[model samples]
Target: MPGPVFLEGEKVTLRPPEEEDVDLIQCWMNDPSVWRRALDVNPTSRQQCAEFIEDVLQGDDGVHCLACDDSAPLGLVSLNDSQYGPDETSRARDTELAYWFDPDHHGQGYGSDAARRMIQYAFEDRNFRRITARPGSFNDASVGLLESLGFTHEGTLREAAWFRGEYHDMLYYGLLREEWNSQ
Candidate 1:
């Protein structure tokens, strides 16, 4: 069975990963349609998926959740400590947002709903001052989603990422708690 719901949204529920979800997670991790835009493009084995679940269960530093609706899981959403500086102390008040959904579920508003909830949790519940997201320049959907969520285009790292046989730029976006509250 899936783990308990960690947060609920209009169209999705965020839950911690369970051991039974290893196969599905591994499948998503290895899917080119999903990983092509993600930072880590390497394929994930079932064992690695299980280990990730174990780490999450054992109190990992980040909040990792599976986005699910009534019937099944649609994707993964996470708020990890933003490594924006040379040390942890410099990034204590920031978190980085990341998510990916099943290709079949794209453009259905689930990703937006899940991401909105995670942003709320980061800023309001977790007391984070800012949340950041770095999407590849080629990922139009991701860039659009981040923009639609009230994130500002902070900057871009030109040719900072290598994927799909060539280098791609990475777009940086940030939303402060004040900005989110004002929206």
Candidate 2:
């Protein structure tokens, strides 16, 4: 299947995840060093990865895009778990953003590029007024990136999640359309 392009950036392009990406995703998600930063890093099999592709293709609650440049896939960026107001245009459309890049690709700014494009897509194309992110408090890189993108720290959910066998705070960040527009 031809993977439909979703959003593009100078250094990164986000596209609808296709079956061809499953192997790459499996390697990244199952790699211990890489998976630690993922939302769920459990050991995953090829079948599980295929199932994930299926879910992403369904696109009911969200969309998952693979970030790539000239050579290969760099990461997975997803905008999902959306909630809207009473009416379609009632102005309450909000969504959660989740992204993870392979550890090998870290420090190359792929995440930043993909995030900027995704935020633009959510605001201009999807009509989302607010975008939120829940990053583990200990993830300094993530927190720094979100802040740099003008995503304000909204609050902290104390001990709201378990990661690496310990309870960790979940930091909530919200970026309003106006905030992005001003940027």
lDDT of each: 0.87, 0.83
Report lDDT (Cα) of residue 126, candidate 2. 83
Clashing pairs in 2: none
Candidate 1 stretches with Cα past 4 Å from truth are 56-58, 84-92
122: Cα error in model 2, Å: 0.5
Model 2 regions lying over 4 Å from their true place: 1-4, 83-91
Model 1 Cα lDDT, one tens digit per residue, 1-183: 357888999999999887788888889888999888786777788888788778763355788889998859999999876686423465558889999999999999999999999999988788888899999999999999999999999999999998888999999999999999998
**Ten-residue region with minimum lDDT total, candidate 2:** 82-91
What C-alpha RMSD separates each model from the true structure?
2.3, 2.2
Q: How much RMSD separates candidate 2 from the native structure?
A: 2.2
lDDT, model 1: 0.87
